[model samples]
Target: MKVKSAATQVHREQPLVLGYKVDIARQESVKAMYDSLVEVFNARLDSLINNTAQMEPYKPFLESDPDTYWRTWEVNIQGLFNMARTFFPMLSEQSLQVVYGEQGLWASCVNPGAIKIKITAGALEAVRNVLPDRLAIAGDTIAWLASDRKEWLGGRYISCPWDMEELVAKKDEIAKEDALKLRLVV
Candidate 1:
């Protein structure tokens, strides 16, 4: 009886490569996000021009803690920006724009009466702008070409109000934009 080593057995079992066309779509997506961030950050810094004070704190942290900041930004805002930037164009081209609303709007209207009315109104306005009529009109043209359906995605944009209320309460204590930039980099 011959003993086949694990490595040799695994190698023999593995499938042979054929006409391989490795799709690097995900890698491209990640690279696009990185490039956009670099562009936006550079533009933002350039607009400040000679403001050394603005970049002072972030400079040290940027060199030391890029990965942490990248992860934090990726989850908080960059991810959203990247997804919208990439998918929105494709969706627009394909004529599939789905609009969703936050349930908080209705909750605010029902509870606390007038106190929450303004917030709810603002939220509604934001929602409206996100799914503007003009975009919808263009979507119709793309829909015709792609044979896609035009519809509202419809979901609760707002989750819990408690977190927002807490943020509002502590707004004064929150760090300034420059401090935040430094913290984010670190």
Candidate 2:
């Protein structure tokens, strides 16, 4: 899909919709999809925006459906792992790998984030009108990250709504400390 500000709508690029959901013919389908993608862009990627996700119903662990929970884990977490494992090496030097799961993160604790909205009017929709990360913000941030200067931001879980000025101020420290990257802290 063409994601951009209204002014930039004139530009359009092919979107690759490859996914593992259709397991009946997933391997063959994925191979065809990737083959075309590799051919179109010569197997070179400037940036890979992985927004693939699934969310389980809000419930206690014991009450939650095992199938539903695992599906969420498989798609949101494992999906990223698989995509990265296969596609990351295609990243050109100074390219980006972004997992935008927590986009508009300030809007909620976050999963299947605030990006999509169910429109209702004159109702009890306590719509989050604050800290709302506009679609443009996410688009702009992704573009910024796709640039060479933001290379250090790679291999991380990036928040689309992170305070830009604060991040800019701490950019040096972030790079130096290798902060904001995905890591498991003991």
Candidate 3:
């Protein structure tokens, strides 16, 4: 009920936005979401942002509950896989650059830095005594990335806190070295 209410408020403010509640961990639910999106948008989406995440309170691996720890994996990894697999065909090729070695589609991962949020007294309370980053930092960076000029950044990991202009300045160097990717150091 709260989710629906929030969705209604968002739709009122931004009519272009559409919202649907789905269990992203379930492939069937994700497929249903894809079907609904395809019906509404005629099977072409400009951007897809997978922001669903589950973070358990900081704890040692041996001390953490097995179910809770794996729930994070289900929500984070499995959910991402389901969403990407279902929505890949619907993504617009013209707007975003090529990604996943595909000629027509583009995909990039973004790490939106931790922004200031109200943290009640809890396990995470000690971790952030004072949150320094503003919400606009991540929001604006993501908006810029979704714009037409960010095609070159496809398949790269983008950190929202980085200065976009300076990052753009180093694009050549980044591409040459294939930086910002997960690499195992021997």
Clashes of each: 3, 0, 0
Clashing pairs in 3: none
Instruction: Kindly list the per-residue Cα lDDT of model 1 for residues 1-186, writing each as its tens digit.
Output: 122454467675543222222122234654455456445544221110010001111335436566655554554455444444443333333333333232111101001112222223433444534542332333333333223321211121222222444534644554332111212233
The full ranking of all candidates by TM-score, starting with the best, is: 3, 2, 1
TM-score against native, each model: 0.23, 0.61, 0.80
Q: Which candidate is the best by lDDT?
A: 3
Error of 1 at 24 (Å): 13
Where does model 3 exceed 4 Å of error? 1-15, 92-98, 116-123
lDDT per residue (tens digit) for residues 33-132 in model 2: 5566688778876665665455454556688788876766776676666655555556533233433333211111112224533321222335534325
Question: Could you give me the TM-score of model 3 versus the true structure?
Answer: 0.80
**Whole-model lDDT, candidate 3?**
0.75
Global lDDT of each candidate: 0.32, 0.52, 0.75
Q: Is candidate 2 or candidate 3 better by TM-score?
A: 3
In model 3, the Cα lDDT at residue 185 comes to 86
**Considering summed lDDT, which 10 consecutive residues are worst modelled in model 2?**
103-112
Worst 10 residues of 1 by lDDT: 46-55
